[model samples]
Target chain A: MNLTIREALLAFRRAPLLSALSVTTIAFSLFVVGLFGLVAVNLQDALRGVAERVEIVAYLLPGTPIEPITLATKDIEAFPEVQSATYVSEDSALARARAELVEFRDVLQELERNPLPASIEVKLRPRFRDADHVNDVAERLRGFGFVDDVRFGRDWVEKLDRLRQVAAAVGLVVGAAFAVVAIIIIGTTIRMAVLQRSREIAIMRLVGATNGFIRRPFLLQGAIKGMLGGLVAIGLSYGAYTLINRWLIQASFFSNEQAVAIVGFGTLIGLFGSAASVGRHLRRV
Target chain B: MIKFTNVFKAFPKGGLALKDVSFHIAKGEFVFLTGHSGAGKSTVLKLVYADEPVTSGEVRVSGFNAADLRPRDVPMLRRRLGIVFQDFRLLEDRTAEENVAFALEVTGARRSSIAARVMRVLTQVGLAAKAQAYPRELSGGEQQRVAIARALVNEPSVLLADEPTGNLDERATRGVFQLLRDINASGTAVVMATHDLDLVRQAPYRVIELQEGALVYDSAVDESRDQAATP
Candidate 1:
């Protein structure tokens, strides 16, 4: 609608090879970054999902009464972080163990008495399912007289934290590299466009056109290329992610029906945002 | 409307392109600048448009001092003065109509206005039928005409043509000179630099000739014919 828009459209239409090549460069660069982004997001989601499936077991004191433990279990369930908690009495635990060990039932009968401790099995809300939050809650529960021991998986928690730190560091390095490459690609393309249009630019200047008017078409060209490239990258990244996800599901490696919830929106938004950012950077000069 | 007062332009190798050159052209005057090769014919035009600064002395055009003109104001000076080159200098990629419209387009003319003005100028140059043709598709004369049309698109008060017909034949040259005369008659000051002595002697305009960067001849019916005796 605007004059600049007309000029930009003319520039884009005039140079097909240049426009295509520029857009393709942007697409390929962003595709690499987007692909990595999808992997990082899905990995974090998968790990978080696995952590939520683990349950917490709080052992009761040897002299604790079943009624008090049941009351404590109900109170724990009322807490916002606790998903559900069930009281397991000693007699019920011994009976369940004997039924499961039919061969071991004779071995268990050979023992002097049924030997199993009463415990409360607890599940936490998804938000509180991380190892750090679960451990914090477990420590708080241990202060209760009914809770003789509180266990969730301390070693596993520490290991996952270390791995997450490493992954984050790697992501930072890779993201920085991608950003530098994107800038170089955009700068070079713009420089080439400037050189190719130097004569036209000289003539425009001679004809009393301002620098702003002369530079507008090039800026528009850069923006158009960036947007087209971003769209391409998004499409390719999502298509590949879908195929890989389907293959994983068929192989039974992952059971969740929706493995990549954020992939679609995040990838699309990120692609568009980065493309716009590059456009702005190119225009500033 | 141009004034040159003792203007001295020097090249890097101490070559004096114009030595103590001084002249003035009033509104609607047609003038010719003739000289041998490297006699500083184009250099004078360059000075008028502020393309090159005077080494010394004063040069003024359209109320702006060439020496005091800023870089940003150079384009404004150029817009008021049309320049026609020997090579036509048309954008080889654009059509004749587009080339003519380009001058108006750069001055932020509306698309409708540009179209109208370009059509008018192309018709004036007798190239209305060839408006869609590329520079490569036109004859040498037509291309030069297109350049002339571009120069006149802004309706410049002062049109400076440096060998506008250098590549054309005698008939094309006469046609181009006739067009210049028509434009000059219509209140546009025309200054043409050419080496064609016969065209100068035959066409009959105020002639200023330079021999080695010095004005050697000035002949006009209104003038005293005093400088013609000096050289």
Candidate 2:
């Protein structure tokens, strides 16, 4: 029932069409940003899945004693970057090859001796799963006298690292571009709303209303419109997420904090946009 | 009270709107500002109300100086005066009562007293029965009355009306003129700008006439001078 709030609400009722147009424009613009956010989130998820496969396989020299190998596995597991290290004996290695390599199954089965070497497979922690960290762990593994050769698919790990960097760089640039576009569009819409009510504004000024007083209702109205738009955008994003989940692939929606941030972004845009628009008008007339 | 000393106003694009214009209206005086179109009548009123800046002179209205008035102080100056235009200027979306209350509401008046004050002014303007009607629903005369009521709700010391009856029929014009007179009779000074000579003759108030942005004649000054010369 406050006058500012009352005046703001009155505007919506006075020009429902213009008000609705502003909200819809804001909603669609924010929705685009939200969609891009969804893509960035899912891309990060896929990259993380790929990064998890970066592991160092330290093939042991033949005739290495079991006790030292077991001790070395524990030492490797104790490395800060290493998540876990598993020691695969020669026999188990041969068995795994026969089970996994379908084309070589018969050949592996008829082998006279186990040609596979025992190895310690070291998996790094999520944060450390990168080309540099993998190479560091592999070099450490080679320090072991019995480690015949340490292979961590150097090229593949490096490529994954490059892909993650490119994904982040593109997401940042494109997401920023989308957000800027949203601000401009919403600002223009708010400016139009201000222009639409120029008569009321002139009257208010004629009646001795201060610039601040004149601006309050507009700011409030803009914030409300922006908030509504943000809510609608969130709903739209959720719908898109649901469809993608149902038909395309399992996709995750925005977390609660991120969703609220989107709405907050909208509210801020509305507030500042109205401020700029109204400030310009008040100064001009 | 309003006083202008050698006021000059220039248009933004080009040309002088008012050049060396001067006038003074004391409290409780009803003055008619008469001029043909483009005679700078509205520009003078605008200067009085600080709507337009003084190009090179002084305009002191109700204790606010226009020569150096800050942007923030303009509203304060306006609150002490009411301004009307040719157009009714009422918010079409608001009812007559709301339209009047809007003036008081902007000044942060107490809510408890606004309704009573609005009704009193509406009653004074003879539109009490149409308080709930929107501007679009009211006739042009009735709309002007509502605008007058809004201007009076603040109990202004001076009311500035620029062609208040410009859009009204003869009957409505007479009625609105009578209302302005009544408002003036109650100790509120009224400065009316118009080109209607008929309405000017209907009242005995002093007249100040302008021609092409210059004060061509002032009946108060000229009449007094003529009487002194005849003696």
Candidate 3:
């Protein structure tokens, strides 16, 4: 093991130009794959947030008693799939609308009375929060006698979920394609290393070196390139994401936690890709 | 000890390299395989090291059949025999010591023992002072000595040299042949292939001569020893 590492380091030092080319190739390919992965992750998060909010907004009859409203909220919350249900008064609804449109705050203050209705908004857990499930919950909420109307965006929620599925599928195909290309590039580099060191290989064979001893240094060299490429890839993609989302004020990108997971996942795949590539050619060496 | 009986070697390009050759080298014997270029001298040495498989018949080294040995065990077979090429085949980037240590390193020798063994072999080849010099920095004779050091470092039972002094001038050739004699004197059997008849005449060891892939003369054997394939 020690000799393998020492020889690999020596081989690495010998081929600065080739090593740089391999690292750059891997970094660029991984950057693309990682960026797409980041996109899918962030989109999935957004879709989940949207799906969880696929609630039935049950507007009560105006001037309804607080007792009935509180009872309905509690009942919805107890449902198996319901995440939470909260009752909002007319004034709080108006305030929320004003918060959403802060530029029109003065315009909203000109209103004589709150135009929004006091309602119970029922939110479902992400697993059960879909068009069909939200509509089923809406149907149950309509049974309340004091409920004036039950409304939910069933069609829009279904369309959003479909979009997310398509996006995720596309991301997977493209990411896998790039990953394969990256692996081939790494394989080619290892092949070059083998050819360049053919004399050394022959000498080692002549000196009774085992196949494992002859091949280990090349394998380690590939793995080291892979690991460095992954790090650079993570840095480039994450840097781009942060630049667009944080520096340029493009909100709603991947959260810090989501970013970390995606980067880690991308780096692992990169490492595996490089290892597999070199391993495939190692037999020839 | 090495033995080849009725060994036949066919090239990939469809010609016989060696046909029904048979010979045996006893322990500590120094034998010279002499022939013109393309006369199958190198093939016999390669067969002893199992570097090339016999087309048919059996060539055994250290009691292992050359053809039937498993691929995994080929290295183990080679570990008992050192090989030196005419070109030296040293890793040009490494120093003389590193080149020598490479043989022991491949055999998984301990680090503490590697330094001592490398020093001993380099000293044996009269190259201890040039241990730190790279191949490019060494003279042609010095480089060949390093190759010999590498081959000897493993303390193999037999040493196979294919034209060990092929590239050397007359003076360097004598030095290399003397070293081979010294190594053989220490009880390791030496099998050397050389077309240099002058060197062969100077050394009083047995000479096996080949003509057109058939054994023509073997100085150590009786007249009846020349029984190779007819065509």
Candidate 4:
């Protein structure tokens, strides 16, 4: 045990430049991949936040009975998908217009009567908040005898959903590619280590040391480099996130909690990636 | 003990290095394998350690069949024996004591036991004072002695030396020869390969001479038979 450690430390001392190169490569690759994942996670969160607020407004028909409008509100609210149904009377809608458009207030007073129609705003439950579910609910509400028009920004909701799916797919493909590149770089570093110590390995083999015994120091070196690289990558990622959030608020993405969770997951990836890289190359080395 | 029965060894490029050679070295015996440059002396040693497999015959060393042994088990077989080379294969980077301890380390020997065993072997080789000296700092004879100590550190039953004094002067050669004789006297079998007939005559115990990879002379049976007739 003591001799193995001594040998591993000697290997590090002898090849400082090679060890540094390997660690730097792992850190750089892991940082890029982690950054991509972080952005994707935050984007998904923001899109879901917007999507959850999606609700369709149903305007009542002119000359419709008051009892049916009240009954329609009760019916919409009873649906499993509807979170809430708030009735907006014609007078309230006109008042909201007058408050929102102060410059047009005088122009609105010139009119003899209010043209705004009574309506009900339907907010869907969280699980039913996606574009497809909202569109289905709006169509069902439009089937009511008193409903004249239904509006809920369906085009915008669909666009955001499409963007989310595309982002997820691209992230998966690119993430896999970068992982392979990182593993290859680690494997190359290990190969160089094996070549450098080929003489020592030959002597050990001649002295009846098994192949596993000869390959151990290199494996230990690779593992250490991997663990150190993962730590550096997480640190750099945290610093970048903090800098962006503090100065360039527009560029800020994830919450502090989300960043911590992502970095925790990324460290595991880095360790397993480097171990696999070393294992694949050990057979040939 | 090492035994080679009608063993044939052919290289990949074609041509036999050892052809139909047969011999046996008994326990506690010291024998010399004397031959010309390409007369298959080193190949015989390699075969004994299972470094090279037999082409068409049997090689049994310390009860293990060389040809039938698995590749993974070859190291275990080698661990039971000691081998020295013509170049005095010593790690130039390590000290004399480290070179000896390396043999024990590869087998996962204990750290506490290793120190005592290394010191014992260094003392036996008469290089106790040079334990901390590196190979580059040691003389050729001292380097060879370190190699011998490394071979003896494992306390193997059979010691195979391929021209241990190849790079030494007359005095150094005599010193190395005397060391081998002493090691053999301690009940360890020694098989040495050399072409120096004069050195072999000085301490004649048994001689197995090879010519074209064939066993041409074995002085054991011939000398005893002649002695019986003369009486």
- DockQ values per model: 0.50, 0.78, 0.75, 0.62
Off-target runs (Cα >4 Å) in candidate 1 are A53-57, A62-138, A246-285, B4-23, B33-59, B65-75, B195-231
RMSD of each: 6.0, 2.5, 4.4, 4.2
Model 1: how far is A20 from its true place, Å? 2.6
| iRMSD, per candidate, in listed order | 1.5, 0.6, 0.9, 1.2
lDDT of 4: 0.81
CAPRI tier for the interface of model 2: medium
**Candidate lDDT values, in order:** 0.78, 0.93, 0.82, 0.81
Better of 3 and 4 by DockQ: 3
lDDT of 2 by residue, B82-170 (tens): 88888989988889999999999989999999999999999999999999999999999999999999999999999999999999999
lDDT of 1 by residue, A162-204 (tens): 7767877988898678766765665566566666766776667
lDDT of 4 by residue, B1-231 (tens): 788889999987999999898888899999999999999999899888877678999999998988779867877887888888878888777899988998999999988899999999899989999999999999899999999999999899999999888898889999999999999999999999999887899996799998888888889867878999995
lDDT of 3 by residue, B155-197 (tens): 8889999999999988999999999999999999999999998
Candidate 2: regions farther than 4 A off: A62-80, A87-116
Give the CAPRI class of candidate 3. medium
Q: Tens digits of per-residue lDDT for model 2 on A1-285?
A: 388998899889888999999999999999999999999989988888888888889999999999999999999989999899999999999889988999998898889988889999989999999988888889989899999999978899889989988999999999999999999999999999999889999999999999989999999999999999999999999999999999999888888999999999999999999999999999899
Tens-digit lDDT track for model 4 on A117-186? 9999999887787788888999998899889999989788788778777877887888788767766665
* Model 1 chain B worst lDDT window (10 residues): B220-229
TM-score result, candidate 3: 0.86
lDDT of 2 at B161: 98
